[model samples]
Every structure is written in C-alpha cells, then in structure tokens.
Target: MSTVKEAVDVEVPLHTAYNQWTQFEDFPNFMEGVEEVRQLDDRHNHWTTSIGGVRREFDTEIVDQLPDDRITWRTTDGDTRQRGTVRFESLDDAHTRVELTMDVEPSGLVEKGADALGMIDRRVKGDLRRFKEFIERRGTESGAWRGRVRPGDPGGGLI
Candidate 1:
C-alpha cells in the first residue's frame, strides 16, 4: 500500500469541522475526483470516484468511528483496496486541525506512476485546503452531530 498524509488548520471549532465531515455527500463539493459518496447507513457507503483518470466504484465499511475525533474505513469491494482514517484536533475554540492518512493500491501503471511522483499527496492536500476555505467562509457548520466515541471503541461499524 502507498500512503499519503496531509493536514490543514481550519478556522472553525473542532465540532464544526468534525460534524461537517460526517456529511459524506458534501465531500464531492470540495474533494477532487470524488464523484459521489452516498451514505447507505451509519456504517456503510457506496462511493464513486475517478482518481488518476481511472474511474472506480466501491463499497466502504466504516470499521470504527469516534464522533468529533476520528473515523476509520476499509474497502469491501473494488479493483483497489484502501483503508484510511481522519482525525480532528482542536487548536483553540475557533480553530481545528484536520488530518488524513490513506493507504491505497493503484489500479494501473499510470496511477502507480502518479503515486510514485507524489501527485496523489498533492491532490489530497489540495482537497483539504479547499475544504478549509469552504468551511471557513461560512463561519458556521453546515450540520452537526453530538455523538462521541471514546478513543478505543469503534463508535459505529462502517459509515
């Protein structure tokens, strides 16, 4: 698996950032190449995406989640297998740090080449930057959830 790690500081409270993130459908608004993300249930989703010019579909199972803290997911079906987690860190009352780590297997030579050259990392970083801008401009969360999961427990199984 090839991994990419990126983070950005957002001008929003930790809860705002974390809550907005739970709105899976909103991802495509800021995330590049994420054509669609439909939350089938609290712990399951169907995703359609095009990365490195290759279109792919997958069903992801959220193996663990902790509201306003972190989320973990794994692919259940697809040409590629991926697992990742996103964490929210509070910088202060009005600012939060969002970090993401993803491990992926490229589906083809071109995709592999792009990964080797760090293009994927750049792309993911860009996505985070855009998300930061989008959220900060609004100055309030688009939505929110009060759920909380302690560090060790899997809050929900796949979402």
Candidate 2:
C-alpha cells in the first residue's frame, strides 16, 4: 500500500468547500483522470476513471462523514483497492483548509512503478489545486448533502 497526503487552502467558507465535495458527480470537472461519477445513494458512488491510459470502474462506499468536517470512503468493488478521507478546517470565516489522505494498493508492476515515481502524489496535489480553483471560482457548491454519518452508521449517513 502507498499513501499520499495533500492539502490546500481555499478562499471559501468551510461549508462551501465541504458542500462542494459532497457533490461527488462533479469530481470529474476538477479531478483529472476521473471520467465520471454516479451517486448511487447518499453513501454509494460508482466511478469511472482513466489514469495513465488505464481505465477502471469502481464502486465506493462512504464509511463516515460529518458536515463541514470530514468524509471518508473505501472502494467496495472494482479494479481499484483504496481508501481515503478529506477533511475541512476553518482557517477563518472566509478561508478553509482542505486536506486529503489516501491509501492505495498497486495491482500491477505499472501501477507500482508509477507510485514509486511519485506520480500518485503529484496527481493528488494537482487535484487539490484544481479543486481550490474550481470552488473559488464558483464561490458556491453546485449541490450539497448535509446528512451526517458517524461510525457504525448502517448507510453511512443520518436518515
């Protein structure tokens, strides 16, 4: 397993940043290599991505979430095995710090090589940078889901 951590400071309120993140389907707009994301439910998402010429489809489940604080997810079924979390912290009323930490398992030599070369790390950093630009330019979320998800929640969100 390889881990990557990145953070960015955006000139938006914490809720703005956090809300934008909850709109999973919009990730393709700012997340490079992500082709599509479909929200199956509040806690389930289907993702299609092409990275380094490799196309993959995956089902991911949100494990825990807290409005304006953090969201965590793990791959449920697919060609990818990974887990990650994104956290939002208020720098001030008009500034937010977004942090992401991911753990990925490389399936083959090509992926392992890329991971060793720091490609994954760079990708994550670039993604965060793009997210910063995207949210800052919009100044508001395209959509949002404010339901809370605590540990042990059956569906990963408060109903």
Candidate 3:
C-alpha cells in the first residue's frame, strides 16, 4: 500500500467546508477522474472513476465521522483498494483547512508503475486543489448532514 497526504485552505467557513464534503455524491464536481459517486446510505457510497484510462467501480463504508472535524472510510468491495480520512480545521470564522490522507493498494502493473512515479500523490493533491476552488467559488455548501458516526458505530450515523 502507498499513502498520499495533502491539504488545502479554502476561503469558507469550517462548517461550509465540512458540509460540502459530506455531500459525497457531489465529489465528481471537483474530483478529477471521478465519473460518479452515489450515496448508498449515510455511511456507504458507490464510486466510479477513470484515471489514466483505467476504470474502476467501488463501494466504501464510512468507519468514523465527526461533524466539522473528520471523516474516515474504507473500500468494502471494488476493483480498487483504499482507505482514507479527511479532516477539517477552522482557521478562522471565514477560512478553513482541509486535509486528506489515503492508503491505497495498486491492483495491476500499470497502477503500480503510476504509484511509483508519484502520479497517485499528484492526483490526490490536484483533487484537493480543485475542491478548494470549488468551495471557495460557491461560498455556500450544496447541503449538509451533521450526523455523527463514532468508532465501532457500524457507520449507521444514528448519532
């Protein structure tokens, strides 16, 4: 597995940044190579992505979440293997910082080569930069779900 970590500061309030991120189905709006993300439930999602001509479909389950703080998820079934976390930090009332970290498993020769060449790292950084631009331009979140999902919560978001 290889890890990628990146962060960006957005010109938006913490809640605004956090809220926008909760809208998983909207990821394609900012994420490069992401074709679609379907929210299966409060804690599960299906993702379709094509990167460097490689297409993949995957399902992920949120393992932990805290409003305005962090969200963590891992792929459950898919051609891609990954686990990731995104954290939101309030820089001020009008500014926020978002951090993303991921551990990914390369599936085949092409993917492994890309990873070795730092393509995956750069891709993740670009995604965060796009997300920063997206939220800063909108100035408001499309929607939000502030429900909490604690460790061992089974990702139901009942809290």
Q: Any idea how many clashes model 1 has?
A: 4
| Regions of model 2 farther than 4 Å from truth | 155-159
lDDT tens string, model 1, 41-85?
A: 777789999876689899887776788889888888878688899
Clashing pairs in 2: none
Q: List the residue pairs that clash in candidate 1.
A: 43-158, 43-159, 44-159, 62-158
Q: Candidate 3: lDDT of 151?
A: 69
Candidate 1 Cα outliers beyond 4 Å, as residue runs: 146-159
lDDT (10s digit) by residue, model 3, range 30-117? 9999999999888899999998899999998898999999999888888999988999999999999999999999999999999999
How high is the lDDT of residue 141 in model 2?
A: 91
Better of 2 and 3 by lDDT: 2
lDDT of 2 by residue, 3-29 (tens): 999999999999999999999999998
Go through the candidates in order and give each one's C-alpha lDDT. 0.85, 0.92, 0.92
Candidate 1: worst-modelled 10 consecutive residues by lDDT: 150-159
TM-score of each candidate structure, all chains considered together: 0.89, 0.96, 0.96
User: Which has the greatest lDDT?
Assistant: 2
**What clash pairs does model 3 have?**
none
